[model samples]
Target: MKTNVYGDFACYYDLLGWSRFSKICAQRLKNFVRFRGKGDETILDLACGTGELEYRLRKTKLRFVGVDMSRRMLKQARGKNKGVKFIHGDMTSVRLKRRFNIVVSFFDSVNHLGSIAALCKMFKTARIHLREGGFFIFDMLSPEGLAGWELVEIRRKPGYTLIINGFYFPERTLAEITIEGFVNVSSGDSSGKTTYKHFLQKIYERSYPLDKVAESLTKAGFGNISVSSFDPDEPIENASRWFFVVS
Candidate 1:
C-alpha cells in the first residue's frame, strides 16, 4: 500500500507543520494581489492542501475555489472553510467554469507533475479558467533545488514525526522521495492518550528550466510574464524555489 500518498495521510497533513509555510505564501499572494491583481477578488487555489491557505486568508474579502486530487484532502479543506468551494480533481486537468482573477499553486507543487507535458496541462488549465488580465502565480523547484534532494531528513512537528529519504536523478531531472512517518491521532477510549499511526509512501518530482516554463506560458498566450524567487523582490538565479507571475 502507498501509505503516505493520500487517504489517511491527507487527513493529518495539517499536523505536518505546513501551516506556517502556507501562511507565508498566503501573505505573499496577498501582496501580489494588492500590487498587481488590478482589483481581482476571485482566487483559485490549485492543490490546496487542507485549505490552510484559504483559512489564513479568511479575513480578506475574496471568494476562493480550491482543487485537489485527494478526496480526503479536499474533505479536510472543506471542513476548515465551509464558505470556500472545493473540488476533487487533478491539477493537470481540472476545469472550473468560472474564471478567477488570480490562480495560484504554491509550495513547489508544480514539480509534482513529473513531466513537461503534465506541467503544460496545468498551465493550460490555469489559462482556461483565468480572466483576461488575471494573474497566474505558481512556484517551482529549479534543477539546483532538485540537486539538494539527496538526503535523509527527520522532522518533529507538533503532532507528528516525519522521515524522508530523497533521491535525485539528473538524467531525468526527477526527485524521488520515500516518506515514512507517524501521525498522532486522538483516541476516544477515555484513557486521555493519543496513538501514533505509521505511514509510508513514495513521490516523484521533476525539475524544469525557467526558459521551458516561460515558453509554455508564452504558448499559453500569457503576457507580462515575470519570474523571480519565492520572495518576488529577489532574483531567481540563486534561489532554490522560483515563483512565476503571468498576466
Candidate 2:
C-alpha cells in the first residue's frame, strides 16, 4: 500500500480551524446547487479534504462523490461518510465516465494548482465531465487577501506538536506554508518522536481577473459564465474569494 503523506496529519487536520470555514463554504455551495443545478442526483466535490463537505451534503437529496489526492484525507473522509464514495485521485486528471450536474472545489483549493496552465487544465477536466448545463463552482484567494499579510509562526498542540510557518509574496500573489514538527508516539519504556515536514505553496492568482476566468471557461467550451461573490447575491468586488459559475 502507498503511504499517505497526510494520513498522520489527517487526525489533527481539523485542529487547524478549517472545519468552520469548510462548513460556511459548503453551505454556500449547496445554495448555489439548489438554485442553478439541474436536480441531478450526482455532485462532485473536488479536493474534498477530510470529507467535511461530503458529510454535510449527505443530508441533502443529492448523491455526493468526493475526490482528493491525499490518501490520509480520504481515509478520514471514508470513516465519516461510508455511503459517499471517496476516491483518491488528482483533481487535474479525474476520469469518471459519468457526468455531474455540479462540480465544486472550495476553500481556496484551486490555489493549490499554482499556475495558470494547471488551472486551465482543471477547467478543461471539469468541462469534460460536466453535463450540458452543469455548473463548475470553485474559489480562489484574492490578491487583496494576501496584502499586508506577513510570515508568522504558530504552534498548536492537539496530540502531537505542529509548527506552522507562512510567508506571503505580494508581487507574485503567492503564499508558501511550511509545517515542521514531531509526532510523539508512546512505547513500552519510553516515548519516541518522529520528525516530519510538509510544504504547501499556494498562488492567489487574483491577477487573472474575473474576465480572464470567463475567457478560460469560454475556451473550455463552457457558456453562460458568471462570476460573483461567494454569496452569489453579492457584488463581485466585495468578495475576497471569486466564485465562478460556468455552464
Candidate 3:
C-alpha cells in the first residue's frame, strides 16, 4: 500500500501525492506470463491500496481480489469499487477459501515484513494460495536503494501539503518514515476557506539480503525462484528495486 489508512492516516491517504502507473505495471505482469507461454487469469493483489491495480486489471479478462491489514483502506477501496472483493487481514497470515493463478504483491509490500520470518510466512501463504505451477510475484527495496534514500521531502498541492522525513536504523536494518500533513477542510468557496486539518503518521519497513530471501522462499517450497532488477529483462543488478518471480 502506498499509504496505510489505519488510525488517522486514512484521512490523508488520498491527499498524499502518489504517481499512477497501474496500467503499465499490470501489462508487464501479464506479458511476463505470456512470454513464458503460460496462462494467468485469476489474481490476488496483496496489499492492494485503494484498488488501483485491481481497477486497472479488471478491464482485462483477469479475475481480481485484494487483501490488506488496514480496514479503512479497504473501506475506501470498497467505496471506489462496489462489486470487487476485498479482505481485511494481515497479509502474512490471512486465510482464503480459494486459489489463484497469479499471486502478486506490488510496490515493495514485502518490505513491510518486520522480519525475515514474517517474509517467509507470507511466502508460504502465497504458495498455499496458488495451484500447481502457479506464479508468485513480489517486489522489495534493495539495500543500496535504502542507503541512498533522501531524508526529507516536502510536497504541496492546492488543498494539501505533506512533509516526509526518513532514516535508516542500522541496528535493525529498518527504515522509518515520519510524515506530517496539512489539509484545507473549509466548506463553501475556496476564497472562504479557513479550516485546516493536520495529521501525522509514522511507518517502518525492513528488507533482507537477496540470498536470505531466496533461501526463505526455497524453504517455503517455492520452485524456480528468480529475482531480477527493476528491468525484468536483465539480471539482478544495482537497481533500486527488485522483482521476485517464483512458482
Candidate 4:
C-alpha cells in the first residue's frame, strides 16, 4: 500500500491555481470526449485528487467513478462532490470489476509512478477498466519540460507560507520537488491562543523517453496511440507535460 504522500498537501491542494487548472482541463476533456466518446458514458478517474474535475463537470450527464491512493485527498473530494463514487486504492493495481467508457489520469499523476514498469501496470489497469474501444488519457512529465523546473521559490500569504524547491537530474531523467510550509492553527482555551504546525512533503517523479512510453502502451494492449504536448499554443519541444491518448 502507498503511504499518505499527500497528507498535508491535501489540505491546500487547491490554494494555488490547481483548482483553476482543473476547470480548464475539464472543459478540454469535455471537448475531447464530444469527438471521441459517446455523450452518455461512464468515466473512471485515476488519481482523482480532491474531485476537482468531477466537480467541474457536474452538469454533464456522464457518470463518474474516482480512485486514488491518498485517503486525505479522497476525504476532501467526497465532502465536496455528490453523486460520484470515489474509491481508495492505488492506480497501478486496483480492480473495480466494472468497466468504463473513458479512463483518465490528469495533472501528471502518472509521473509519480517513478518507473516504466509501474507505468505499464497503470496502463494495464486502465485497459482492464475500459470497455472495448474505450479511451485512456493520461499526462506525463516531459524531460524537456522538467528541465525548466530546477529552481527555488517561496510564497507567503495570510495565515500560511510555502516554499518550493525543485531539482531535475538529467542523468536519471528524474525530478524532485520539496515543499515545506507552515499554517496557523487556532484554538480557544481559557484564553484564545494560536498555534502553528509545519509540514514538509518531498515528491519524486521520473520521465521516460516518448518511444519507451509508446512501446509500453503497445505492450499493454493499446492501439492507435497519440501523444501531444499539454498546451496547444506552445510548441511540443518546449512544453513540460505531454498527453497520451490511447484506444
Candidate 5:
C-alpha cells in the first residue's frame, strides 16, 4: 500500500479539529441534495478525508461512496463508518463506471490537484461520474483565503504539542502548510518517563481566480456553474473559500 502525503497525520485529523468543520458542510450538502434528490439518491465524495462528512450525515437518506488517494486516510474512514463504501484512488483520474445523483468534493481538496490543468482533469472526472442533470458541488480556497493562512501558531494539548507554519507565494499561486509535532505515544513507565513520537508533514495547495476556474469547468463540458462564498448562497468576494456548483 502506498503511504500517501496524509500518512501519520491521518491519526490526528479529528484531534486537530479538522473534522469539526464537517458538520456545517454536511448540512449544506444535505440541503442541496434534498432540494433535488428523490430520496434514493447516491453521492460520490472525492477526497473524502476520514469520512467526517459521512459521519455527520449518518441519519440522512443519501447513500455515500467515498474515494481518496491516501490509504492511511481511507483506513481511518473505513474503521469509523459502517455500510459506506470507501475506495482508494486519485480524483483526477479515478473512475467507477457508474453514475451518481450528486458528486461532491469539500474542504478545498481540489486545490491539491496542483495546477489549473489538473483541476480541469478533476472536473472532467466528476462529470464522468455524475448522472445527467446531477450536480457537482465543491469548494476551493481563494487567494484571500490562502493569504489569511500565512501565519505560525503553536498548540498544546494533553498528549501532544504541535507547531504549524503557513506560507503563501503569490507569484506562484501556491500555499504550503508545514505541521511539526510530537505525540506522547505511550503511558509513563515505572520510571515515570513517557515515550514521544515526532512527526512532520507538509501540505501544498494552489488557488486560481474565478474566471480561470469557470473556464476550466466549461472546458470540462459543464454548461451551468454557480459560484458563491462558503455559505453557498452568499455572493463571492473576500471570503476564506468559494463554492462551485457545476452541472
Candidate 6:
C-alpha cells in the first residue's frame, strides 16, 4: 500500500497547526489509560506520523513504539525522541515481536486503511499483537462529517509550494485527494524547479458503524469493548469527529 497522504507532507506535518490538538488527543488517551489503572503498560502508536503521540507518552515516562510508513516522518520523529523506538512499517501488515497492553492510532490513522478489508486486517493485527484484555484505540471520520466539509485547493510554501485539492463521494463513502507541488532551488545565480503529483484515496468508512466496530472487536477477542467519541466518555454520535477506544 502506497501512502501519498504523508509522502510529501511528512516534513510540514507538524507545521500544519495540529500540534496542540495532537497533544490534547494524546493526553486524553493517557488519561483514559490512567483512569483504568493501566500504568506503565507497553503501547504501540500505529501510523504515528512524526511520533507526536509518542512524544506525549515519553513526557509521561511511558514506554512506546511508533510505526509509520514514511521514512521522512520517522526521521523527524527520531530527531525529537531518542528513547522511543520508531519503525518504518505499514499499520495493516507490520508485526511486532511482542504484544502491547495498549495500541493506539490517532488522527484518523485508521481511516488511512483505505478499505473495509484493510480495516479488518488492521483490527485482526492489533488483536494479535495485543495482550489479553488489552485495548485498541483509534479514530475515523464520520461520513456526514466528510460531506459537511468543503473541498478546496490551497498552496503552502517554503522551499516547496504544495497544492492540495479534495473530492468527497458520499455514495461510496470515499474521498480522493490530489496533491501537486513544486520544489524550488537556487544555486550560483541559477534557479530550478521540480514538480510532483500524488493521489490518495481515503474511504469515509461510515459503513462500518460504531456497533460494527464493537462487533469486530468482540470477534477479535477483545473483551468489554467500548466505543465513544474522542472525548473518551462521551456517547458515540454522528457529529463526533472521532470514534475511539475499543478494549
RMSD to the hidden true structure, all candidates = 2.7, 4.8, 3.0, 2.4, 2.6, 4.2
Which pairs, if any, clash in model 6?
Answer: none
Comparing 3 with 4 on lDDT, the higher-scoring candidate is 4
Over the stretch 1-247, how does candidate 3's per-residue lDDT look in tens digits? 2433455666556556341545556777778767753453788888876677776666566777899888777876787776789998788898897898889998767888888888899998899899787889888887766654448988888888888899887666678888888888888685875887888887777877888989999988997987789765645677677888899
Supply candidate 1's per-residue lDDT for 69.
Answer: 82
What is the overall TM-score of model 1 with all chains considered together?
0.90
Against the unseen true structure, what C-alpha lDDT does each candidate score?
Answer: 0.82, 0.69, 0.77, 0.85, 0.87, 0.69
Tens digits of lDDT, candidate 6, 179-226: 555545345354454543343323232334566656666776677765
User: Model 2, residue 26: displacement in angstroms?
Assistant: 2.4
Per-residue lDDT for 1-247 in model 1, tens only? 1212366667667777655678888888888778865444898999887899999988887788999887888888989998789998888888778898889998767888867877888888889889887888888888888878989999887778899899989988888887888987766688988888998767778888888988888877787898888755556787788878887
The TM-score of predicted model 5 comes to: 0.93
lDDT of 5 by residue, 7-123 (tens): 888888877787887888898887887676776679999999999998888887889999999898898899889889999999999999999989999997988878899899999
- The 10 consecutive residues of candidate 4 with the worst lDDT sum are 1-10
Candidate 4, 152-225: lDDT as tens digits:
98988777788989998998888788889877766657667877778888877778888899999999999889
lDDT of 6 at 215: 69
**Candidate 2: stretches off by over 4 Å:** 1-7, 37-40, 147-149, 153-162, 180-207, 231-235
User: Whole-model lDDT, candidate 4?
Assistant: 0.85
Point out the higher-scoring one by lDDT: 3 or 6.
3
Which residue segments of model 4 deviate by more than 4 Å? 1-4, 185-195
Candidate 1: the clashing residue pairs are none
User: Given candidate 1, what's the lDDT at residue 245?
Assistant: 83
Candidate 3 lDDT score at position 59: 58
What lDDT does model 5 reach? 0.87
Number of colliding residue pairs in each model? 0, 0, 0, 1, 0, 0
* Model 4, position 195: C-alpha lDDT score: 78
**How displaced is residue 80 in candidate 6, in Å?**
1.2
